[model samples]
Target: MLPSGTFVLGGAASGKSAWAESFCESSDLTLNYLATGQARDAEMDQRIKIHKDRRNDRWQTIEAPFDLAPALAALDGDSIVLIDCATMWLSNHMLAETDLAAAQDDLLLALQSCAAKWVMVSNEVGHGVVPDNALARQFRDAQGRLNIALAAHADLAVLVTAGLPLTLKGTLP
Candidate 1:
């Protein structure tokens, strides 16, 4: 059987996405990269391009910047789905001032019922010093809470640093 799900967290530049990509690509199954990044600037565009170059055409990329739950619903049962980076997705929703609570609720429901191997990537924003701006602080806390909730439901939780992955909870199968 599939090893349930994994919620992976790390800081910026951490190997979290790379590790998740590796996990998905190593498998012989059809791969799905659920990209959450939206090219808001040139830097971001370059980052997205770098990620794209790292993968071969064998992997299918789905650009779901928001309403990620619906994207999950549309996926067939046979793919290895890796949602690369949740922070960007959260930021995207926040930019639209979307209902965070409702989105998370729908996401949890989708995750629980999804009959596929899912790896969610998020930035662990709570580990560092608090941000100076109130909005930044709120974003940090909200992202942290989101990660915590996902980790609780995930069969595996991983913390990545220095290109290495440390299993925080559960086993890899």
Candidate 2:
């Protein structure tokens, strides 16, 4: 059986979201997708469309670009949520100039108290070269911290590289 929470970590185009989606689909519970990405430009719009095309009628998508706690709280034990992912969620918060610590705290609390099983997808940003700008550096630092926290809180943590999953914390179901 899948655990209460799973943290899926990977680099860009590492197939983490696809793996997570498959994981959730294997579960008998109702599937809920908590999308955190926003299409602010043409490239992003195309990306969103591609993701949307991959999911069928079985997945009920909730768009929470900035705030996710409320949508996460609304799920019940019969549901399995795939938050794809934390990287975009953090970016949204950072761009909005929100308090990162408080926002992260709220997210963690909500995930902890939520009744439904959940899988969170996050990018492994620290593997890349150090960014040159202040804002980029800040985002990298924040993403690293968030990933650490999520991994600590999750019952199962998996790292996806080149579409392969390596268990980091718990046994894969």
Candidate 3:
């Protein structure tokens, strides 16, 4: 059985999203996709399309590139939301010069109070070499903090590597 909250962490192309999606699909709740990615370029557009193509009509896609709290708040207990890739969401806020601390607080609060089951997918960027620039380093630090918060809040926390899941917190359902 899927828990109320699950945090899925992985590197790029680690199959974390696929694993998260499959976990949600196993549940009986209505699937809700809270997409945080924006198509800023051709490659990004194709990436978004691929994600969309993977999800069928059963998923109710909600495009939330900047503000996710509203969409997350609207879900009911009968829904299971997949917040695909929080890395992009964080980047969107960072690039926009938004108050990241405030934004992260709001997101955590929303997730805490949400009535629906949720599986958040985030990139595990801390496993790589140190970034050469300030911005990259800042993003890495922020993502690490965010992932820690999410994992602390989640009932089940998993790290996906080489398309395999390794439970970090709770038992895998």
lDDT of each: 0.85, 0.94, 0.93
- Ranking, TM-score, top scorer first: 2, 3, 1
Q: What's the C-alpha lDDT at position 145 in model 3?
A: 96
Residue pairs with backbone atoms closer than 3 Å in model 2 (clashes) = none
lDDT of 3 by residue, 1-173 (tens): 78989999999999999999999998889999999999999999999998999987889999999988889899999999999978999999999999989999999899999999999999988877898999999999999999999999999999999999999999998
lDDT of 3 at 10: 93
lDDT of 2 by residue, 93-167 (tens): 999999999999999999999999999999998876888898999999999999999999999999999999999
Between candidates 1 and 3, the one scoring higher on lDDT is: 3
Model 1, 1-173: lDDT tens per residue?
44668898888898788888887777777788899999989999999999899988888898988877777877777877898878998899888899999988888888888767788999988877778899899898889889989999898998999889898998765
For candidate 3, the 10 contiguous residues with the lowest summed lDDT are 123-132
Error of 1 at 88 (Å): 0.7
TM-scores for all candidates: the values are 0.95, 0.98, 0.98
For every candidate, C-alpha RMSD to the true structure in Å: 1.3, 0.7, 0.8
How many Å off is the CA of 61 in candidate 2? 0.6
